[model samples]
Target: MTALAALVDFWDEEIDRWVSGHAGVSDRLQPWFESYRGRGHGEVRLDAFPEPYTGRLIGNSTPVVMLGLNPGAAVPRFQAPGGVFFEQLKTLRYSEWAATVPYASKEWESIAGPNRFYQNRFAFARRLLGEPNWSIANGVYFELYPYHSSGVNASMEPPGDVIREFVLDPIGDLDTQHVFAFGKPWFSVPARIGLPPGRVLSAKWEIPSREARIYSLPSGQDLIVMAQNGYAGPPGAGDTEALARAIGLR
Candidate 1:
């Protein structure tokens, strides 16, 4: 199997282990699971929730990538394990799954609205790669922690081996030219991985006036990380476009 295929298999096995309640799995996920469990009735079973595994590989590498903290919470009915949505994830057919439209189904639309989160989040990529080329098939969207959570769990920390193997190892092979990481929490990841400290750029025009940091990877690529307050909402078109230009994305 190809390296990307093996990575997919790794994700599949990890998710399966989590859902099956296997030993050792809970240790990594316990804090978040316990937090969700505490909320009581009307809560979706953790197993029924979809795993975060969107993005395609072009012959084992991607030119661009996006990173996020974790998958946001959603109702189980929309992403049950045996359903079509989950099936797409299992097979890695993520063109529609990772598109700006996300799943491209009317049922999903009714439940999730227009997906402004992605539409807004992906604006920089759309500008850099053009609308047609800005997609998971062309790049990737990796979550530092792969599970779904309603809110940020300050107590949860992903295992070191998982980050080294599943994340950093794969990234090292990608030959990626650029990486865009959203949220402030991501600022610490590079440092933890032994990368040189990123340089913070001024973006005074941004609503709420957030700063963007740029890290030059050893592989000669750029990793641009941004943080925003929740109240300010996801980055808008102007915000992304200006940042893209600021970084010389052209």
Candidate 2:
């Protein structure tokens, strides 16, 4: 099968096994505070608690890749956790220009509606092009930590194997032109991999972004590491400009 097909297979058939140890999580989500006690602040064993990679596989036509941190309350661990979204993925799996399976809103959300990140990413994309049409513009939208969670935090580095297989490998093969990692969590991979070993040119960029610099891989794809935190939390209310400026979309 193709790389994209392999990714889908991993999410569909292989991902749901995270709930094996728990009784009712398969039926309904078990709160992280209840079952897996320390997940929020501790290590997430990828081999045992494998969370499927969320987000749509909206084909490989677009030029850029927007990588997020991880899912929030909306995209529960299981993509088809027995609900309307599950049925959505069932239909979306066959089509190319669609697949908002993990989009929390609904299937065809990307095709039929405004995407989750489009409006958020406008802080910069807007300046590049007025009233940015984020719709299906990026080739792939995913997270570095694809493991499902209830807003939990993993270590600086997750299992290398998981990264190599699900993230790095797929990105290497995909039609990726530029990779924009949103937050510190998503940006850590580049350091661990030890690429160009340089600093960003922009001095005005904030903390995490101030530390981040752009690098290119052998695949001829540019990997941009931003130094700012993700567009999350209360402070994030003002993070739009910093994010845009940090990534040079400003």
Task: Give the top-scoring candidate (TM-score).
Answer: 1
TM-score of each model, paired residue for residue: 0.72, 0.62
lDDT per residue (tens digit) for residues 78-195 in model 1: 5555654555555543433443234335766777666655555555566665475555345466776665556663533454455555555566557677777778766766776677
**Candidate with best lDDT:** 1
Clashing pairs in 2: 51-148, 208-227, 209-227, 209-228
Which tens-of-lDDT digit does each residue in 1-250 have in candidate 2?
7666676665554333433333123322222213333254343333233333443453546445556655433333333345444444444432221344333344536444655444455334443333455553443556655434445454445544555566666676677566666666645566566555655645443345344556776567777666444443111323435545554555
Which portions of model 2 miss their true places by more than 4 Å? 1-5, 15-59, 74-80, 90-98, 101-118, 122-131, 136-139, 194-196, 206-210, 229-250
Off by over 4 Å in 1: 1-5, 15-45, 58-63, 81-84, 87-102, 130-139, 153-156, 159-161, 231-234
Give the range of the ten consecutive residues with the poorest summed lDDT in model 2: 27-36
